[model samples]
Every structure is written in structure tokens, then in C-alpha cells.
Target chain A: MIKFSINKAFFLQALNATKRAISSKNAIPILSSLKIEVNSQSITLTGSNGQISIENTISAKEENAGLLVTSSGAILLEANFFINIVSSLPDITLDFEEIDQHQVVLNSGKSEITLKGKDVEQYPRLQEVGTNNPLILETKLLKTIISETAFAASTQESRPILTGIHLVLTNHKEFKAVATDSHRMSQRKLTLDHSSDNFDVVIPSRSLREFAAVFTDDIESVEVFFSSSQILFRSEYISFYTRLLEGNYPDTDRLLVNNFETEVVFNTNALRYAMERAHLISNATQNGTVKLEVINNQVTAHVNSPEVGKVNEELDTESLSGNDLTISFNPTYLIEALKALKSETVTIRFISPIRPFTLIPSDDNENFIQLITPVRTN
Target chain B: MIKFSINKAFFLQALNATKRAISSKNAIPILSSLKIEVNSQSITLTGSNGQISIENTISAKEENAGLLVTSSGAILLEANFFINIVSSLPDITLDFEEIDQHQVVLNSGKSEITLKGKDVEQYPRLQEVGTNNPLILETKLLKTIISETAFAASTQESRPILTGIHLVLTNHKEFKAVATDSHRMSQRKLTLDHSSDNFDVVIPSRSLREFAAVFTDDIESVEVFFSSSQILFRSEYISFYTRLLEGNYPDTDRLLVNNFETEVVFNTNALRYAMERAHLISNATQNGTVKLEVINNQVTAHVNSPEVGKVNEELDTESLSGNDLTISFNPTYLIEALKALKSETVTIRFISPIRPFTLIPSDDNENFIQLITPVRTN
Candidate 1:
């Protein structure tokens, strides 16, 4: 039997941390529940979808004054059902007691909920990556790296390895994240003060996305342990682990071009707004394709649909140079990459109308670059 | 050639009003475009999806300082593309000019968009509902009547007429809106200050809902003219029309009971919360079924799923009387009814465990009543 009391806010956080790993529909019945264990000084919750497991702990420390345990035991409760119940209860603290084989009774003020649970003995045993000295990463920086590159990863079922972002660390001083979906690719690099071993890993973009959401802007750092088969990310309150995707990432270093025949710079917001408006027309009539025409010092975007008619608008550009060119690409791709660039002004470099081009921040110090393959139009 | 300039806000409102009637995908290509006509004092915009047509007018009245039209001509431009272009432009006012054969150029600040348009002569003419003397209704009051009853209408495609609300007026003094999906029903009645002719019409709930939303709350009244096949709703700025259902509505007045065997009153908010929580558990396991047991002045909602286990919660009630009752019904039905009632306290009248019941405001109200049939449980 296990009994404890916890503040509503703390309990909600524990549930949210464990929720991401629970599969919406599971073949194994035991995997549908989140296993919760209460010990002398802490309450731990674990949930898994076979490949990815997440565990969160609320310890009985000064910082966690909301938690207090009277006895120690373990039980498994349906993840979504239990979360819904606790979320709806209105009170500062809730009392939890297990009784009658595998039944959980929760009480808060005048609200009492009795939920039938499963035996913890049947729950799956989750293995964690060894706790050897791990690489420490700034939480805020890591989150930015993932968000800036994750969406460019392919979701196609054909190539499983392309679904993750390729992460590379050299001398522990520089961090790089890269992803590509064949047509477009986004890459961001950051140089840190300290050094680290030269290592390479491909983390599933979906898992990184979920992990990033768990940290706040104030979180200082997260300890990462990378084993041959799995990776562990440990923070002050949560531990997350996921199986490493097998297969080598494509060598994309050669894709980055340092020199170009032509380059045009424009205010990020101005270009993004004009592209979105053009996208509005293309998305409805064509396959989200828009053409850009660069003149002396101006660029105009044009989209013509045979049935719905045509639309063309001039975009304000800071400067245009090199060979005057007209290029066509998916407006959505550039919009997303520009968003990740996170700059006031952006520069697009082109070699030819048929060749791929690179987009980078106008400030050379920003080590982020996005590449797009222009669509061939008649 | 036609040219006009209007404040961006005024242009946006006119587009939104007519845009609702334009189908997402229309078989007739011209239906995808919104017809714009600039007259001496006002600009009129119209869009139609065959069955429903909406027309909005922005006149040069003192109140409409946002509009200033210099030419009088009509042209048709793709609705979605034009709206998208106009929305993305930045400035207080936007200038519109027809150039070439059928090209419309829109300019705002430094942004200019040239969109191709179709000949206005090919656009289909919208028919209007005839009128002798139309019934006038307060914009606010009509909106309330539609919202209170629309959701109860049947959405099943088998019976087209059941998808409408039967609106009736006796001598224009009393107004009633009623809708039923066979299993559940909602009705609201109000006594008008002015008189109207005895009129009965079954208006599609969707059309009434759309028409009601187009009016501003401050509008004093809307002149409604009902024809044999269509209904016209005319306001100060918008004119709307929709087709009427041909079938007669079922007699639902007899379903309401004047007295009750057992009446239980509960705080609306408290009851709603408990029901939503219970619904969360039952929605996944069962067919959204929940059982209510009323005994000894307490009401307990219980849901049991052999596979997912069981959950039961007690809802606080103010007063209980008549007899002991164990009833089963979809919690969603009562929740929606209570929302429509919009009252502090609610009273649920029960005839028996298996019979239908009526839900009303705790304060005696003959103006509004909702009926829900109990589900049979083994």
C-alpha cells in the first residue's frame, strides 16, 4: 500500500512529463497505464511506449514542500483517465491512497475520485542508459537547436533515418544540428565555451521536440548520456530516454556552398509577408509553388493559376546583385527557413535558376544556414 | 475602368461578410469569386454557394467614414486570393483599380498586388425572397434564439428537415424557436413587444446560425421577409438569404411536461464540471454513457467499463425530492442544456428511471425548456 499528499501543481507537472511516452493505442495492455512508485523520500512516475520511456520524480525536499509520503508501494493507473481526473479536481493539495487490490482513491476538498488501477507487477520494466559522466548542455541553447532544425526532417516512412536530426559535436566547443527532407535542409551551429569529445548522433526529431517543450527558458542545463543503442537526458526533475535510430545520416557537408554567383538581401518580415500572400494563391491553385524575379534592386513574386487567375506583388529588398535571375521554389519552405533564421534581414544566394540556393542571416556571425532546391518551371 | 479607395478595416469587414457564403470548393468556377460593384455612394460585395447568398454594402454615410468610392462598375475576382492579398497589405486605406481587360490592382503603402479577374457579365444573378410586409426582430434577441436551439437539431443526413429549427410567430407577439434530433430536444420562447402576422417556417439551423452572426449587437432590429422558397434577412449593412426546408416539423410541444415526479436542483457550474470529468473516462471506454443515481438527497454519476475499469463521482446538489431514482443518460445532453439555460441554478425533472426528463432554470421559467430521453441500461 502507498499513501501520500501532493500539491496540485506538482502533481500536474509529473503527469505531463510522463504523458508524452504513453501511446494513444497500445497492443500490450500494461503499456496503457503509467506506473507510479512512492518511496520514503520521493514519488516517481514512469510511462513508456516501448521505444521511448519518461520518468519524473518529485522528492520530499525543501523545494518540493508539496510532497509527503507515509508508506512505500507501486501501482499503475490509466494515463489519460487519471490525468483527466486530477486536472479537473480543484484544490491546492490532493490526498492519494491505494486500497482494495489495485484501486486508487483521490480526495481533494469535497471532490473524491475512485479509479480502478492495474497491478504494477505486470508493468514493463524500463532500462536506463548507464550514468557515466555525461555531456552537459545549456537547456535554452539545446531547445533552440532542436526547434530551428526539427521541422525540416522527413516524415516519410520510406527512409527511417531521415526522420531524425543529425547532431554533431567537435571538441565539445561547437554544437551542430542538421536536418533535410530531400528538397530543403536547415542547419544551425553554435560555439560553446567548454570542450567536448568529437561525437555524432541522430536523435528522432519528434522525441527532441517533446523533450524541448519540458524545459523552461530558465532551466540551466541538462545532462545527456549517449549509449550505443539509447540516449538519456536527465534534468533536475525529469529523466527521458529513447532508442537511437539506426543507420548513418547522409553526408551533407558538401551541400553548403560558400560562394555564389548572385545574392539578394531583404528585410525578413517584408519578404515573409509577401511570400505568405503569394503562398495563399499557390496553395489553393498550384502545388504551393511561387516564382521570384530579381531586377536591379527589387524582387517580385508571381503565381498564375489557369482557372483562378494570377497574382504578382513586388517585395521590398535592401539590395540585389550579381546576375539578374528568376527562380521558383515552394514559398512555404523559404518561409519556414526564414523563421528559423531569426534575423531582421536575410540574404538568398543563387548560382543559377536551376541550381539550389542558400539562405542565411545578413549578419555573418550567425552560424545558421538553410538551402532550398529551386523547382524547374516551364 | 473602375477605381475606388476604402479604409482597410472597412474592406476587411465587407469581405468577411460575403466570404462565408462562398463554398470551399465550387463546381461553378465563378462561384469562387466575389462580385464587387462600386456605385456613387456605396460599394457592394456579394458571394454565393448556390443555396446561400450573402451581400454586404458599405455606404458613404457619416457612420461609414471608412468608405469612399469614386467610380461605378462591377467586377468579379477570386474570393480567397483577393482576401489574402488585401489582408497582407499594410496601411490605413487600400486603393483598388481595374486595369487591362479584367485585371484588378490593389495598392497599400509600398505593396502592390495585381490579380486577374473574370468578366462580371458571366457572374450568376442572385435571386431575392419576395416581401409584402416582413417581420422585424431585434438583432440581439434573434441571435439568442438561434444559439439556444440550433445545436439540438439533427445532423444526420437521412432526415433533411430535422436539421432545421421550426420558428413560429403567433400575431407577431410571441416568438418560439424549437429543434429536436428525435432523441433530444430544445425550445425557447419569447413575447415580442410589437405584433407580427401568424408565420411558421422551418429554417435550416446552419443558415439561421450564419445569418445571426452577421449582425452587430447594437443593431436595433432586422426586417425579415419570408417568401415561399427563401428567407431574406436585411440589416443596416448586410443582406443575407437562405433556402427553407420544405417538410413540416414534428409536433414537439406535447413532449414537455408541466409537472414532475422527482425534481433535483443543482448549481449549474458544479454539475457541469462533474459531468465533464465523468465524460472523459466514459468517452474512451463506452459509447459516452453515464449513469446517474439519485437517493437520499445526493446524486452520484457512475461509469463502469469492464475493460477500462470503473469510476464514480458525487455531484453536489441543492435540493432533491419526490422519490429514489436511478437513471442513465448521456452526460453531454444535460451539459449542453445547462449551458443554453445560462442560469445560476438548474432543475432536472424526472418522470421515471426510463422516461424522458426536462431540464430548466431553477427559477420558474416557462420561456425555455429542454427534454432529454433516458438511455436503457442492463
Candidate 2:
């Protein structure tokens, strides 16, 4: 049994953070309970699954001396319901005491609840990945790279390697992340101020996404550690870990081309608006095609479905410099690319009618590249 | 061919409003299209289903008018895709011309395409609901009443009459709305400065909800007209009609008791927070019972489920003037009642453990009352 008094606001935040560490599956009942231990100066909470675990400690002012050691024990309680009650309780003092061999009493003010708990010995321990020289990078830059490239990872289970983003760190300050679904690809580059030896690893996109969601508070830097088969991200208070996919990523550098015969520059907002309109009709069909016709000085968007008719709109263009080209591609790709772009105007370069096109920022300073392969239309 | 040009923003808003007038079913294809008719000074767009129809006209400037009447005709175009394309186009002059017997060319600069059009004569005519001396009420007030009372209406189809909220207007410048689903009930009252003859009507909650969504611009008053089987809400720019559900609504007046044996007052926020926590566990069970125990000066919420465990919370109360009572009711009902309250404190009146209880604003000047029936718990 553990008893402690904690600041209500601070405790609520810490509980929320710890709750995300537990999984909902009851396959391992002990894994769902939050382990609480009180010391002289602070209370510590540890939540873990077999693969990953998060430990959070909040410091408190002690009113009694010698740690007050009323009880120092661990009990497994239901996670979902426990988090809800803790966040709603009005009082800051949480009285936790064991009632029977397996039942625990939790009291806050006039409210009292008895919950069944599992033994601490059944809970799995978290494995530590050797962090001899963890690479440190800005948290915001890492988050940006993950968001931009993670969406392109293949969601299919047939190819397990394609579901994870390939990360390669050159020296200590420069890194590249790439994700692809075979048909389309996205890549981003980030430069860090810290230095380390060159390292290469692949982390599952799902785990990376979950980490980004839980780390809402902005931090200056994050330390990344990797073992032979796993990766870990360590911040100030939480460490996120995931198993790495075992396979060699396909060579994709040769696929990107710098040459282009046709190029069109337009406002990202205008292009997005046009594509949104076309999507309304094309979305009903399986292929969802939107055709772009570019001539000497103008461009037109034509969206058609034999069953639902067609829509044509001439969107204003900034400039068009290239041979007259009519290209048809999936509109969904263009919409997503435009959404990721930060600049007002975007320049799209096309190699040929059948080749993949590149979407780059018009300002030419950002080192981001998004490529989309066009679908062949008969 | 019907050809005209109007402000794209103005046109888009009118189209969006009229699109809601179209029915999803294709029983009559013409009903899915907006009929555009060009006159000397204005262009009228009409979209209709058998039950409801909306017509909006946009006046053209003197210079914009060529009476360009090469041909006066009507055509039926698909509503969904047309509205999307028109709204997305950049703010520019739109030229519409008929290319052939069944095709219309819509061009704005280089973006031009010919779309197939259906004969306008195939469209269904709008049904006219006769009106007598219609009553006028503030739009904001009506919207508030609908939002506060509509959620309590029965969603089940077995009791058709319970799916609508009963609205009664009295000559004493007062309007009342009531809704119930047998388990819970909500009632709201508003006083109007304008006098009108007493009228009672039942309007479908869904229709009122849709009407409220389309009413973006606030107006001083809205004219309401009632027919034998239909009710019409006429704003300055749009007229919405809904068919009344046919049946005799159960008399709920007798269910409300003026006096109670015990009354308890608590902060709305505190009670709401406690109920939300209790619901976290009770929601897992079918009965969804949350036991409320009001004693000397405290109220405790207890929710127990053998399958998912139990939760108990003792909530602080401002005052408890009623005799000790233990009652169990659906926590969802109380949640909805708390949401409808506008005051900081709410007063709950109880007469018996099994009878319906009343929750009203702690302040005597507020005129909203909610009733919830207690479930029999063994």
C-alpha cells in the first residue's frame, strides 16, 4: 500500500501521461495497473507493457517526517477507470491502503472506492536499450519530419519493411527520413547541432505517431537511442520505445530526377481549392482522377466521371513554362502534398507524361521533397 | 439555355442553402438539381423535394445585364458536384452558355468544359403551404430553444409522436417547448414582447436542427406559419418547411409535480464533473445506474458493475434541505439536464425513490425545468 499527498493539477497531468503508457488489452492483467511508490520527497508512478514502459515522478512537500512509511507496496489496478477517478477527485490527498489480500481502498474526501489489484511480481520489467552515445536533436524538427514522411508509409501488412520509416544519420548533425508506399514517396531532412557517429535505423511509423501525440509539451531536444533490433526516444520525463522491422529498405535515390520538360507554378491555396472541387466528383469512382491541362500560359483542371457527369474549372496560375502537356494523376496525392507545403506558391516539375512529378517549395530554401507517380489513364 | 453571372461568394452561399433542400433519394431525379432561371434583373435558383423547397434570387447590376437572352430555358444539374465546383472557383466572372441541346459550356478563362444537362421541365414544382397571420419570434431565441430541448426527443421509431418537440405559443407573450424520451424530459420557456393568439404545434426535431444549421446570419425575428400538416419557417432569404408527425403526444403535464418532499442544491460544475466520472464505469453496463445518496450535508455518487468494477465519489454540496434519500437513475439523463442549465447552481427536487424528480435553476428567475425518472434498482 502507498499513501501520498500531491498537488491536484500536477498529479492530474502526470497521471494522464502515465495512462498512455499502458495498453488496453487484458492479455497481461498486471501490465494495466499503475505502480505507485512514495518516497520522502516525491511519488513515483510506473506503467509498462512487456515491450515499453514509462516512469513518472512528481515531487511533493512532506508534512510528516521519516517518509511516514505507512505502507510501501505495489498493486495492479484497472487503468481506464483509475485515471478517470483521479482526474475528477477534488482533494489533493490520495489515501491508498490495502483492505484485504487483493483489494485496495482509495479515498478522496467523502468518496471511497475498493478495487481489486494484482500482485507486483506478475508485472513485466522494461528493457533498457544501451544509450552510450544517443543522438540529440530538436524536438520540433523531429516531429515535423515524422509527420511529413510517416503518412507515406505503406499501411499494408504484406511488406513489413515498407510500414516503417527509414532513418539514416550522417555524423551527428544531419539526418534523412524516408517513407514510401512503392507508388509514392516522401522524404525530409533535418540538421541538428549535436554530433555523434553515423547511425541507421528503422522505427515503426505507428509507434512514432503515438509518441508525437503524447509529447504535447514542447521540449528543446530529444535523445534517440537504438539497439540492434529496437529504437528508443528519451525526453525529460518519458521514454518511448518500439521494435524495429528487420529488412533492407529498397534503394530509392535513383528514382528522384532533377530534370524536367514541363513546370507549372501556382498558389498552393488555389490548387488545393481546385483539387477539392474535383475531388467531390472523382471521389465517387475507384480511380478518382483529375486531369491537368497546361498550355503556353494557362492551366485548366478537368474532373469527370461518366456516371456522375463532369466539372471543369480554369484556375488562375502564377506562371507556366514548359511544353504543352496534359497529365492525369490521382487528385488525393496532390491534395496531401499541397497540405504539407508551407509556402504560398509551389512549383511542380514534371519529367514526362508517365514519370513521377516533384513538388518543391517555390522559395527554394527548404530542403523538403515530395514525389508522386502518376497513374496511367487509357 | 439559362445564362447569368453573379458574385461567386453570394452564389455559393445561396447554393449551399438550397442544396440542403434536395432529397438524397433519387425517386425523382429532377428534385436533386437546382433550377436556374434568368430574368431581366435577377436570377432565381430553386431546389425542391416533395416536402420542402427553397428559392433564392440574386440581382444583377445594370451593366452586367445584356438580358443576354439568346434563349430562355431550364436544366437540371446534379447538386453535390455542381455546388462544390462553383464554390471552389476563384472570384471571377463566370460565363455560362448552352453549346447544344443537352450540353452547357461553363468557362472562366482557360478552364472550360461542356457538361450534359437535363430538361428543366422535368423538375418538380414547389409545394405551397398556405399561411394565416403568422407569428414572429426572435431567431436567436428559437435557435436556443431547439438546441436545449431537441436532444431529449425519442430517437426510436416505435413512438413516432415522441420524436418531435411540442411548441405552444400563448397570447400572454410566452413560448414553451418540451421534449421527452420516457426516461428523461427537458422543457424551456421564453417570453416574447409581441402578443399572439394561443397556438400549439409539434415540429420534427431533425427539421428544426437542420433549419438552425442553415441560419448563419442572425435576424431580429423569424415568421413562423403553421398549416394543418406542415409548419413553415420564413426568414428574410430562405423558407424552410417540415411535415408534422401525426399522433397524439402523451400528456406530460401531470408528470410534473409542483411540490417535493426534499430539495438539494449543488454547484452545476461540481455535479457535472462527478457524474462524468461515475459514467466512466456505469456506461459499461446495460442499465447505466448511478446511485445518488443525499445525506445530512453531503451527496455521494456510486456506480458499480460486476463486470468492469465500481466507482464511488463523495461530492461536496452547498446545501441539503431534503430528507435523506437514495435514488438510482440513468446517469445520461442527469448529464443532459446539467448541460441544459444556464445557471451556476442547480436545485434537484425529489419526492420518492421511484417517482420522477425535477431539476431546475437554483435562481428563481430562470424559467427552465428538466425532469428525469428514477429506475427501480433491486
Q: Write the residue-wise lDDT of candidate 2 on A1-378 in tens digits.
A: 555444555666777877777887857777778876565566667776655566666645433211233555566667767777667665666666666665766666666666666676666666669977888877787888888888888999899889989999886667889998887888887776667878778777877777777666576777888888778788776667777888899887888878898888889988997787678767865688888888767788888777665768777878788788888888888898888888899999888779999988798635788899988888
TM-score of 1: 0.92
Question: In candidate 1, how many Å is residue B374 off?
Answer: 2.1
Candidate with top TM-score is 1
Summarize candidate 2's per-residue lDDT along B204-268 as a digit string, tens digits. 88888887876664556778887778888887657777787777778877887787878888899
Candidate with top DockQ is 1
Interface quality of candidate 1 as DockQ? 0.42
Model 1 interface Cα RMSD in Å: 2.9
How much lDDT does each candidate structure score? 0.84, 0.76
Worst 10 residues of 2 chain A by lDDT: A60-69
Structural similarity to truth (TM-score) of each candidate: 0.92, 0.87
